[model samples]
Target chain A: MKKMNNRSDVAVKYLLISKDGNALMEIGEKSAGIEKQIKIDGYDIETIVGFPNIEKKEQIVDGIAKIIELLKNGEKIFNDDVLIEYVDMIINEKSIDEILYFTLKHIISSNLAEKTAFFILNDKLLKLRGVVYLKRDNEDIIFENRAIKSCQIDLSNRGKIADAMFFDKVVTVNYSELPGKNIERYFDKNTIIIPVYNIKGVVGVVLLEDDGTKAKDDASLRLVSRLVSLGINYSSITKQLKLSKEDVAYFKESIEVSSTLTHMGKITASVAHEIKNPLVSIGGFAKRLERYVSDERGLSYLKIIQSETTRLEQIVNDILTYSKIFNIKREKVSLYSLLMDLEEFFKDELMIKRIMVKINCPEDLIAYIDPRKFKQIFVNLIKNSIQSIENDGEITIDVERVKNGINIIIRDTGDGFPIEIIQRPFEPFVTTKEAGTGLGLSICHKIVSAHQGQIWLDNYDDGAMVKIFIPSEGEV
Target chain B: MKVKKILIVDDEPNVARLYEDYLKDYGFEVKSINNPHEATNEFYMFQPDLVLLDVNMPDKDGLTVLRELKKVSPNVPVYLLTAHDEYKRNFNALYAEEYILKSRDPKIIVNLIEKIKE
Candidate 1:
């Protein structure tokens, strides 16, 4: 048994064997040539035996046996060709794992003297992905269960083929010369090693053993290289496809949110228009009635109408302000002045309601923000806190500078938000107040989000706190 | 003495009637029409000195009627009425002589009518 590189060499050598054995030889590339020659040889051999009466019976038996042997040999050759063909198809199809499994099965069925297995290079961890036995009887079971079955070699050995993959190197283990404990039980007494390489790195190694003369061959090594290259390319393409899908999903979600915000703006404008007219009418009529009425009782009623009208006007203005998309007119805004403005604006209202308003913002605190939008945010939060109190409640506005940003917290003495609303209070049209349009916190959320800040509601043991955190101007 | 008759046009009868009653109290003879289609007939009969027109109408938009009134009596001052500030800004760009928000107090309306007389 000698290592043969080409099919022609193997066929020629087979003919030489038949002739040397003193047998009548007939070998052709086609199956018919062999069949015809075998029949002629059977008849001639029977005549030479001098059994003319039994020649027909002997010839029939001998021809049948020769034909059966030829067919069996032909079928084995066909199977090898088909296996190679299947490996080529899988490579062309770019099925990495399938090619590995098929190649392993082919190596096992070929019954080469050596025990063989495949190993993939793990670039990230710089190690071998380890022995993928293609021809084990329980290959499917081990693959599914992910446990090493019945191989005496310890896979955890640091100096094995897997470790060599880290340095993009190949290790050839000749079992007859150096029988290492790492893979002694798996291989024959004689072994030869071959390395497989791709553009990225050394991919794997082939293990072979000598029976007599049929040992390691170049054709087998070349096939291994082709399989490794296809495997790497296929894996890369699959990874790219997965990333592209994620990006598409992100883009679709962004588009949906933008459309919803646009619709919200339109609704805000319409509501503002409807509410303003009636508010004006109420305000105007109350002023007129107040001026004409002489009774104190009539005056008080007029005052109540005037106060309510003012509240309605505030709500309309807030909705209009919040619903409009923020185009930050960035400027150096003094945080202290902004807070002071809010304090002054709410001073009279808080006094009237007997709600104490406290501020703890630093005088030197400043940020680059649209002053108008910033003012609106503060006014909304403060007004919300003031409105939350039923009677004799206090509101606190605190601003503090953190390492990378500023944090503003507005807490109220009134009862905290309902548990359900606390989780999603910033969603548009979600309100607990009977008169609220539920756009207050939503607007705050949008404004803060535009500034790349965060807004959240915190429920304390005593009351509710609304906190806003905005990155420092220079930091952003 | 000839009194200047101002025509108040609005879809809401209450709003139109309120302006009419208030304008009359301020010594301006006023006629009102809630139907936008009846605006042409009322304007022709009254020959209003100034027209207070609501921009949002059921049958005709205020700007369209403003153009029609201008064609009939170009010199008669047409004040376009809007309920929103954004609309007020838009009306400022139109050819109308004045734009007043419907939310303006009745006193402001009376003041504007007196100023037009002056």
Candidate 2:
């Protein structure tokens, strides 16, 4: 205003006009370290002449360097639209290794660090199960070491990797500063341990190593880690969904077969007694004639007649068993006691076949079921297993409690189910054996269904396996 | 003490004949009523020590016959012998002494009847 003679104030005005076209500025006083305004042409300017705050100058320089880094990062990210596109395109990649290698390669190419690695966690054991590492060298190459892949981060022994997982965030650590830290072995410089996580929690960790001076954008690194998490989670979800779909399809088919068998059962139940009465008469008459027939030929003929009638009787009984309907009278039955009774029941057959029966039931385990019907299932299953095994084999009945249900597994060291029969094992009149009415598995299916349980058959390498899962409390 | 006289009510003729033959062979006096409608009359006429009743019949169900027979001779033990076991849960069947499946061998029935004392 009055022919200002301050050189620093004039320089401030020129700088503001050149940069922002605004001259309202404040500068610190050299002695007081307090800000004051200097007006020029209806505007103010900033002064730095004898300002004694050397800390302020260093702060400005640091601020400028950060801005420059931000601009450079922004440019790199713009060019990395391809990375975003690659992430979007490779999301459906079936093999996670391919995606991990591609991502590690891309990250290494970005020059964010001297080295990049992805450490995948084995969710079961909480250990590092795999690693995909990329490093800058004479030629760009991605490699993995079995030893590094097996590295287990001892969370108790806190380090950058453990902190990243425990805090559920990115952790930066100077490798040289950490004495006796496990993470130092992996990196020769600074490390940014970024956690890869999803709704299920931290599934993996990402290690970014660089010279201590290189700047890292934590937010961008987090975004990349998230993308990697999404890829892994997507593939796992896809596998589970595929298995669930197959299970649904299988149950749907089982239901259709059950409905058809129910109709046949209804028809069979109506006439079963009508057929059984005559069988009893014929068998009774054969027995009566057996006393008078003295000749061996006559006796043999009578035996044939008696045996055929008995066979007919058994067929009718089997059919009626299949058609029988009863409510699932659920009660808390001691499974250990029930299995023990079955072991006693088949004691003779088991001894005859020289089969070792192993009942792996926890004594305290109890299930809500219709005791009689439940017993019938085990009887039929055990008998089938005994018949399948010729001699000197093992039958294992393992029972365990699961989420909302009880699982019963019966494995027999015998010829597995014929492939054709395994497909429709629960269908009525389906049998792999000769002379049976083929209603055993059908009866088992019906009984399990009445309890709103699931029974499936599988063949192990050396034997047949029957798996049954029912709610702890019977659903029906 | 042995059961001297018994009655069997069943709709099936051959099944009744088989029971009759088997019971006769066991040396117990026995009567067979082929019709459930005529069961109460036969029960009253026979005044037997025990009655064997079938569950299913053409004109009248055996549970109703069982109720009538119990009304006539409340003290006489009635055993339900039926091909179908569903009737064992019927309220009328509670009056019966035992529920035996008809599919059992006739000799088993004979042994069961012989175990009854009068």
DockQ of each: 0.04, 0.10
Query: In terms of DockQ, which candidate is strongest?
Result: 2
Give the docking tier of candidate 1.
Answer: incorrect
Q: How far is candidate 2 from the true structure (C-alpha RMSD, Å)?
A: 31.8
lDDT of 2: 0.69
Report how far residue B63 has shifted in candidate 1, in Å. Answer: 2.4
Per-residue accuracy of model 1 over A1-476 as CA lDDT, tens digit each? 12222322211212211222343322222221221233333222211121222433243234333433442334232253443444234323435556565655555556553345554443333333345543235343123113212232322333444333323333455554432333554555554444455433355555544445454344454444444444444344344444666767887778655666677678877878677766766676677667589999989999999988888887887777776765877777778888887889988878887888788988888787777877878887787777777778788888898998989898888777876578677877788787787887788788888888898897776577989898875443
Worst 10 residues of 1 chain A by lDDT: A8-17
Question: How many clashes show up per model?
Answer: 0, 0
Docking quality of model 2: it rates as incorrect
Per-residue C-alpha lDDT of model 1 across residues B9-94, encoded as one tens digit per residue? 88877677767777777788888888998888889988887889988874787766775676567678888777664544331124
TM-score of each: 0.48, 0.50
> What lDDT is reached at residue A5 by model 2?
23
Report how large a share of the reference interface contacts model 1 reproduces: 0.11
lDDT of 2 at A283: 79
